[model samples]
Target chain A: DVKVTQSSRYLVKRTGEKVFLECVQDMDHENMFWYRQDPGLGLRLIYFSYDVKMKEKGDIPEGYSVSREKKERFSLILESASTNQTSMYLCASSLWILAGGPGEQYFGPGTRLTVT
Target chain B: SQELEQSPQSLIVQEGKNLTINCTSSKTLYGLYWYKQKYGEGLIFLMMLQKGGEEKSHEKITAKLDEKKQQSSLHITASQPSHAGIYLCGADKGYGNKLVFGAGTILRVKS
Candidate 1:
């Protein structure tokens, strides 16, 4: 079974604070992603890394940045957190392909950040 | 931009009843994925359908992709309280790797 783990389940921070959320996958997958889930708006992609040291912006990546210094770990960074950034953060990882097709993503439990 | 629309934003069903959730896309789908998410938890993958007119089942949960590959339905038979959660459908964003998800349908099962 594949397992994805996040560094924190919940966190609270004041506005303008720098926040870091970490994710680690045990399956040695080559692709990792970060997303934020909000009520009504659904999950919006923040960033995705296809390989170590490689990153790409998704639909919504203005306030967020990502780091993939190693294969097993991916980190989401909020250079300066704002109250509007408070939401559930999700991390997912998957192989480039499975059975010659697009692979299914395995997600971590998530980190619920509260920016006050 | 690609978008996925899920119908019946929320549903309430009684135990032993059957219910279905639909996901529709404006463009052809390369792949469709079904996932269930408990409150405050990550998404649990339920099924994946790639080919049009394909159907797959897991226990009492069944998912079908339309012939046009632009729509999919997830049906649950003999519903149980454990089935209550948010159902989200994801579509391959044509980039061959990224995914775009629907707003999600929330299901509440009463015993």
Candidate 2:
């Protein structure tokens, strides 16, 4: 079975502080993505890395950036944390395909960030 | 921009009852996917439909993509307590590898 792990389950940060949320996948998949889940707004894409050192901005990438220094590791960074940035951050990884396969997305437990 | 909208923001069902969640797309759905997430958990891929008028079944869940390829439905038959969770519908327009998700439907099942 594929396993995706996130660095923290919960974190609290002050306003204007820089935040880092890490995710790792054991399957060595080619695609890694970050999304934020908010009530009523759903899961909005933040950023994604299709390969090492290659990143693309998803629909919602205003205050977030990502890094893929290695195949198994993807990190989500918040340049300046704000109260609005606090939400459940999800990490997902998939193989190299636009259309996913059966049980396509392998996700991490998620990091619940709280900015005060 | 591509958008997927899910209806019935929240639902309450009894055990052994049937429930359905709908997903509507603003643009053509190159690929539609269904996922489930327990509170405070990760999203679990349930099913995917690629072609128009396609339908697939798994256990008690059945997902169908309309012929227009712009909408889809996920039906849960004989709902159980374990079925209570947030159901999300996502779409990939074949433009990029990233997926766009809908505002999930929160289902609460009572025995």
Candidate 3:
């Protein structure tokens, strides 16, 4: 079984505060992703990493950044948190066969962040 | 730009009833995925459809992809309260398997 775990389930921070959300996968997968899910907007990708120290910006990567220092872990960083950034954060992992193929993503339990 | 649109933003059905949710894409889909997310929880993968005119079923839930590969439908027969959740359809536009998702359909099954 594939398991993806997030560092926090619920978090609250004030404006201008820096936030870090961590994710770890035990499936030895080569791809990790971060997404922000909001009502009526669905899940928008924030960042994705295919290898250690390699990252790519997704559709909505303006206020967020990512770090993948190791194969099993990926971290999402908020340089300066704001109220509008308050949303559900999700982390997912998948195995990358060759360059790009149909791989099912395994998701974490998600972290609900409240920026006040 | 490619977009995945799901219809009937929300649905409330009685237990034992049958309901269907639709997802249509603006462009051709390389791969389609269906997931279920409960309130305040993570998404649970339900099914994935790649080939056109493909249909897959798990227990009482069935998902079908059209021959055009631009539309998909999820049908749940004899729905139960346990099936209440938000159903999201995602499409892969042949870019490193990155997915674009729909706004989602919220299903509320009342017993």
Give the number of the best model, judged by DockQ.
Answer: 3
Pairs of residues at least 3 apart in sequence or in different chains that clash in candidate 1: none
Candidate 3 global lDDT = 0.94
Q: Tens-digit lDDT track for model 3 on A1-116?
A: 77999999999999999999999999999999999999999999999999999999999999898999999999999999999999999999988865544588899999999999
Badly placed stretches (over 4 Å) of model 3 are none
| DockQ of each two-chain model | 0.71, 0.59, 0.75
Better of 1 and 3 by DockQ: 3
Using all chains and alpha carbons, the TM-scores for the candidates as numbered come to 0.97, 0.95, 0.98
Q: What is the TM-score of chain A in candidate 1?
A: 0.95
Over 4 Å off in model 2, which ranges?
A: A98-103
- lDDT tens digits, residue span A10-108, model 2: 999999999999999999799998999999999888888889999998878998888899999999999999999989999999888644532367889
lDDT of 2 by residue, B1-111 (tens): 888889899999989999999999988887899999999999898999999999999999999999999999999999999999999998874665667889999999999
TM-score of 1: 0.97
Candidate 1: residue A65 lDDT (0-100): 93
True contacts kept of 1: 0.58
Colliding pairs, model 2: none
